[model samples]
Target: MKFNWMFLFTFLALTDLANAQFSSGNQFFIGANTTVSIHGLVLRPTFNNTVWSNKVLTRSPDAIVGEPTASIQQVHTFNEPTSFSGLVGLTYLTGNLNGNTEDDLQIAYFNPDEKYVTTTGSTVDKTIHFVSKNFTGFNNSFLRITATNANSVLPVTLVSFKALKEGEQAQLAWSTSDEINSDYFEVQRSAEGKIWNAIGKVQAAGDSKAERTYTFTDNSPANGQNLYRLKMVDFDGTYTHSKIVVLDFESNMMVSFYPNPLTEKLLIQADDWNEVKSVELVTKQGNVIPMNNSKAGSDPGSREYDFRKYPVGTYYIKVTRQDGGIRTQQVVKM
Candidate 1:
């Protein structure tokens, strides 16, 4: 799939030539059938006489003001759907350097997953910054970019790092863009966010322009708060650590809502009704079924429901606990 040309041109910044005296200007051209890698995308440029004369632009009227505008058309294919995020830095030498000077170069990037642009640049280095937008998903994309605009090149640009609590397990999910030499990702956990131990490792893509996702379930996550991060290792043994994410795993008190495959009635029984605030019946398609409970304003654990009029099918008993916990169980109507 090709990226929308209207959207791509709108986001990219290209310097146009002004009415300035021609000093010594040099033109650079992208040779026919030339292949180049930018960010995490691999692009192959082919000649198109209608849209472009040749994939070429001259540099160094050297002033930044006289730079010519150029757009390189290329094709990028992916095996599966993907998304992208992270910094895109361009290399520039010969500058009055400082810690603050490099810091000021930070730019915002789009997050393909979140469906909205970020508010801030988030992080920055001499070669690392932020992306322009957040994309949701794509199988194959016709990627277009101003080739000369990128500088910083990292193997992996992590889009998201999140941890979800499932009972005593910590489900860790993360994604990356343009992974070039990535070897594998190590799932590390810490209780206090200080000392860390490696629990598991997931193999990396090695080289990929398409966004890639990875998951790791820490079956032995520490009780209470569990801190997690990814140790993304490269094929050459080089590695970088992702930002830390935390998950709070609280053991839920067991509850039973019974008589599965029942004829007409259903009963909900729980050991502790103090934590269970509400009980609701939801269809397989996610629509909630209204209940006519005799004790309408009473505790959820002591409730009963009549399903005689409802269709005989599968449903779910969704229970919302007082501690902001949610539990769901499958129910069947006979």
Candidate 2:
């Protein structure tokens, strides 16, 4: 079921991918917009969307690899059920690593059963090159960067961080698999993704190998476009931030459609579906985009739409409530 890369010895920089498996490649470039949301562990890169392959899967690391006993600080799980035995390289920006000492960092590969596999990476200017050979391959393996301190290790293994509107307040929640020299987590809020103000803080586990859960409530969140991020601070005052979770209440409409620049799927959330009569897609040209993957979104208050089949353009989603109430939102598919 695997197809070899059409090009024998060249690397390609694709933005988005739906369904196509290529062979003879272990290099992935995550640009400024690279969005990695593996099982609620979201990493929205400072860059735009880059290449992603289903075969080469990645998710937040679980409790299996807890302690850094093998010269590995943390591991990022990828390639489930698919073994890798060659080159595995990741090129990322220096700003994203949150490193106190980038000179001590290098990429390391691990086997499926939490065993240390061998690989090394180096930095060049603001770009880091984690390119090396992996002699052994296993399913459900890891692609990790060696860490010199607690600041660098906190991010890759974060379990999940989410934000939601709860009745009249905004709720922020997150969890961690392992922590080192941890002090506490400060929940910060911003009006439009800048000028953040610390809203609340929660105690951390300091140094623990167990899973820890944390939550903070912002009773007075901004009216709309509220940006939330966790300022994870260690005891030494070193800190790192999590991926920003956006909650927009700008619209007066009851139904909420997420990710204006639609990537793979568009999620529509509502408080209640009992009053919702119908939902469908509309184009700017008054054309209808019939969805083959309709009825996709599950229990987010509404249905999820797989807009991949349609061409890249602007579209409108019309929601008709039972009592003749109507709302329309514009979305652009990238």
Candidate 3:
């Protein structure tokens, strides 16, 4: 994350071209880290020796050097000293900065020098001035350089997460290095591992210039081993998905009863039953009917239910654990 001042100088020299007669000096600092500033000055001669054009480039630590093809705007100028001061802003493509390391930020400018001299302060008060000699056929160009710790601003590293357990319900967690322009994080869980579905979502801290942490809890998980991943979305509609994590849970404890084509009442049971918390009766086509609920530490035994209230058909029985475990069985009401 250390700032490279030399690179900034080089980038600016190549970008700002203010006619064929201007040249800019290297950047100089003006304050402590608490209020640091960068200053660069460029002086160019007017069509005649009577007037000289000057530019003073100033930037803060958070300023971004835009693309090479960007246009420069003139903010203010001093006629006698041939100096100009203005705010420069540019937008670069996602992967164009700093050799594509996700850490490089630079702005460049080309200049032409006629007979202008540029100098920066040797101490704090980081100021630079441009002076031009009164001469004919003289012109000068200027470019300004400013830079900061690259790592402190860019978000390039990815966050990762893994699934630890799966069954009717699952648990999920993830981590990240930095987040920039991020909108939110989506938690996706899948029962088959191949087909993913959004089980839940957590809002992101959005455009953070530092490392960030995030987590999401999924209340509804599918039976058996479940797969989990994070889908990071940006405000600009861009997104990336994190690595997958898988957690497996035992399903043998599940109970199923079936005549499949039943008409009236259904039967349900759990082998060596110890305790059951809740049971859900679902039709073969996926309709759910509440069956019964028991207090914790309740004994598990054969259970029967009247389906007279429900149309004759096959159904599924689901048992849930207070600890978030689940077991399912098919039943028929005939």
Q: Count clashes in each candidate, considering only residues at least 3 apart in sequence or on different chains.
A: 19, 6, 40
Task: Give the poorly placed runs of model 2, Cα more than 4 Å off.
Answer: 1-157, 253-334
Assess the local accuracy of residue 40 in candidate 2 as a C-alpha lDDT between 0 and 100.
19
Candidate achieving higher lDDT, 2 or 3: 2
Q: Each prediction's TM-score against the native? A: 0.34, 0.37, 0.33
Score each candidate by Cα lDDT. Answer: 0.49, 0.54, 0.43
On the 0 to 100 scale, the lDDT of residue 224 in model 2 is 48
For model 3, how does the per-residue alpha-carbon lDDT over 1-334 read when each residue is reduced to its tens digit? 2224455445654553432122233432221111111223222223222222232444322323222211122211221233222222232323223332213322222222221122222111112211112222333233433222222321233544544444455656665554545688888765433467887788888755455666666666555545566778877777766655555565656564534555654555566455556677644333456777422222355555666677664455567655556665445556
In the range 1-334, model 2's lDDT, one tens digit per residue, is 2222322122232411222233324544444433332221123333232334553543222323322322332234544433333334343334434423444444544432443333344332334333222333233344433332222232344578888888768888888865756899988876534377988889999977777888888888666456677888878787767766656554445788887898788888888877877776765444444443557466656668887777897776766567655565668899
Candidate 3 least-lDDT 10 residues: 29-38
| Per-candidate RMSD, Å | 18.9, 19.3, 21.5
Candidate with the greatest TM-score versus the true structure = 2
lDDT per residue as tens, model 1, 1-334? 1234333323322322221111111332233334323322322334321122222322222111101211111112222222232222233232312212344332222122221111233233345322222222332122122122223221226877887777667788998876655789998876444477999999998877677889988888755446577888877677778766656565375777668877787777777877877677665333555453634224565556777888987776666678756565667898
Q: Which ten residues in a row have the lowest lDDT in candidate 1?
A: 63-72
lDDT of 2 at 27: 48
